[model samples]
Target: MGGMARYDALLVVSFGGPEKPEDVMPFLENVVRGRGVPRERLLEVEAHYQGVGGVSPINQQCRDLITALRPEVDLPIYWGNRNWHPFLADTLQKMAADGVTRAAAFITAAYSSYSSCRQYLDDIAQARAKVPGAPEIVRLRHYFDHPGFIAAMIDHTREALDRLPEEDRDHARLVFTAHSIPVSMAASSGPSGGAYEAQLRAAASLVAGDRPWDLVWQSRSGPPQVPWLEPDVCDHLATLHAAGTEAVVLVPIGFVSDHMEVVYDLDTEAAGVARDLGMRLTRAATAGTHPRFVSMVRELLEEPEPLPCAATCCPAPRPRGAS
Candidate 1:
């Protein structure tokens, strides 16, 4: 019989990015390592870093998390980056060596789509093979609807609204932004059929009940022939500006940590678009090191649940030519 282990130490997993300009393309390559992303396209991703003093905010976010979590839990908490330093293999090797008996993981993403959830498990399993004595690993379920997280988002958006000129606050449209996906995947992707978008919308609804808000996609990449969710943030902003909307508050619900998407896409690309359109814009902060978020992790660790799986989970069609 296979051995069983109790959940002790906690591992917070994230999609890591490069900390310096020189490391950017190599990091992007790690992201799509197996699939061939053209060198030129990877450079475009690197350019996002160039706009922000050549640093990804991910490492700082991880650092804040480690400090916040150190005191509350009995077992050690370690962070492993999927594509960069403090890499998963090294983190797991150290955990095993440190006598970590069992572990529960909290992926930085709040939803359960394939890339967001399952691929993370694949990373852990691969890391375990290289690091002997890995304890039984269990991942915390996605927290899109967790009360405290949702409440944190609500308060953040409300505060962003307060930042606008008092007169414009009422006129400002609440725009919820998340990383984009190819339309082909959206047709069937998510934990249950279309659950990914639904959960996000639901969370947004909690924040903007009677207020005007629209969910839009950002950071699309694929062949020109491929369709992604629309209207893209730029297009959406332009339309709103043309319609005479003056102020906007962007809430990035898809990401749990403040990463490049929040920085580059919302802060840089999205902000630039809004400026050209003559629209005033501000972004709600990503829920980084929020007390509620730490509490959510503590709750999950004290009493755990498996990620949700249904017949429709990962509804993407099986790839062609696979038996």
Candidate 2:
């Protein structure tokens, strides 16, 4: 195991997505369970999935990542999702059956937030509780700022910029985006608070370097009465168009792959907005199976074990209608 002596296996954890039209609603229900999301809203999001033939690219991306990591690490790599098939509990059952005692978990999310960080840990804990003899699954540290991740983004950003018209390339603004969480959840993220935005800003800065850039949010899914992150990607594109910005490169730094959000939100919705405004736009690819990114997994695995999150870090949001 080399430096991974404390762990017997590496498990890839991700936010699951539906594989077919029939599976869409059920998969979405699992995602929004107990969050009080309106069925109307669920159907609206469901349409986004159906429009793309009801398949989410996330699960396949996870498989590709696992395949890339196999040659880099010696441990048996297992895959599991929080909401869809190959559920965490089932994966844990298999792990236990195989006599795997302890494993290191690498979540697809790279930042700190309730949904991105703590909720995953909570999910793992809950799954372990349900499966007898579940291995001690320790999540790897947040790698939003890791050099390997940054390098991958930088390379992809360059590629996206190249796709723009030659005249627009030099003047194109870089707009980095991520999923937006509710305001209260964002405020309570990480050990102290605001770590979600803080970490994202740090990563965005590293990716943008000296380029003119702005960080925005996308794919917000909460009641209108509540506020999540502001200046959504599409809205920002409109604003940039109005401000006479001719072209932009959208860097989805918040996501690890071209999942549904990246495909529907940025590639579809945001692209439509840009088209309406007659502004040039192209989206930078996520860090999906990039060589440097694949190597990063092994690096994280070989590093010294990470300390557990503080009890209050990235605290979950109180359920809707709570006192």
Candidate 3:
């Protein structure tokens, strides 16, 4: 355990979701926190979870990712989430008890933004503070442009395109979607700013190759008065329909799995829009447990120690009522 022998364990950090009906509201509360998401919005989101029988696919997705990852890396794989069960603090406590001194974290979010990157760092810091002798967590660098991620997405997109009507498959437009952070958050996303959108666009381009595509936003939780990224996926689908696009493949470039956001927002809401508009919309699968994405964890661990984000990078967004 000297130079080049950096860590004892591999931590998989993720945004956790509720696994049952009773856990929904508490989980939502954990997510909105001081961000000032409205009560009405929370209620609406709660209904989304309820409609799906109060289970979010996210927690299971995390479990599956960790299960797939264990066989790939030599180190012990431990998973923790920001919001729900297997909480990061609890996971850290167990790691400490297990005699792990240091670890490399592979956060599920693959890009640089307040929510995606810095918040997870803050979570790790908070969790470590609560666990005596918590392992030093070294977060892996952003992997938006990693070949393994891009390849997984590319293959999924092709599959989605194939799901379209044969006459439309060859001409289907690729529509890449990601969660919409507030405009202010997007403005201050990286060292300089705008790194979130830039990295996402880069990934989309790699996945798209020569195919025509557009990057749109989804799962916007901000209040109506405040602007978030847009046009929202549903609205974008309408725009595509109006533009005479015969078919569209929705690629959720923002998420790594088919969680509630992908399930409720895209498959349910956006897909409804596509149906109403008489348009064909096929959603590409997220890179959940995809072989290359699973292997990307090991690849990241094998790379040189990644530099941490700058202190000024991805500053937190102000609460809705803040002046």
Among the numbered candidates, top TM-score falls to 2
Model 3 is weakest, by summed lDDT over 10 consecutive residues, at 1-10
lDDT of 2: 0.93
Q: Between 1 and 3, whose lDDT is larger?
A: 3
Ranking by TM-score: 2, 3, 1
Off by over 4 Å in 3: 1-4, 320-323
Q: Can you give the TM-score per candidate against the true fold?
A: 0.91, 0.98, 0.97
- lDDT of candidate 1 over 1-323, digit per residue (tens): 11113566789898998888788878888887654446677778888787777788898899898898777666678899899998998998888888886788878888756667667777888998988797667887778888778877887888898888898898889999887776656656664467668878888888788998999988776545556678888888888888888999999988888788788888888899888877888899877887887777777676535644564566533453557
lDDT of candidates 1 onward, in order: 0.79, 0.93, 0.91
Candidate 3 local Cα displacement, residue 157, angstroms: 0.5
What local lDDT score does residue 188 receive in model 1, on the 0 to 100 scale? 65
lDDT of 2 by residue, 88-107 (tens): 99999999999999999999
As a whole number from 0 to 100, the lDDT of residue 213 in candidate 3 is 96
* Deviation in Å, model 1, residue 226 alpha carbon: 2.4
- TM-score computed on alpha carbons, candidate 1: 0.91
Clashing residue pairs for model 3: none
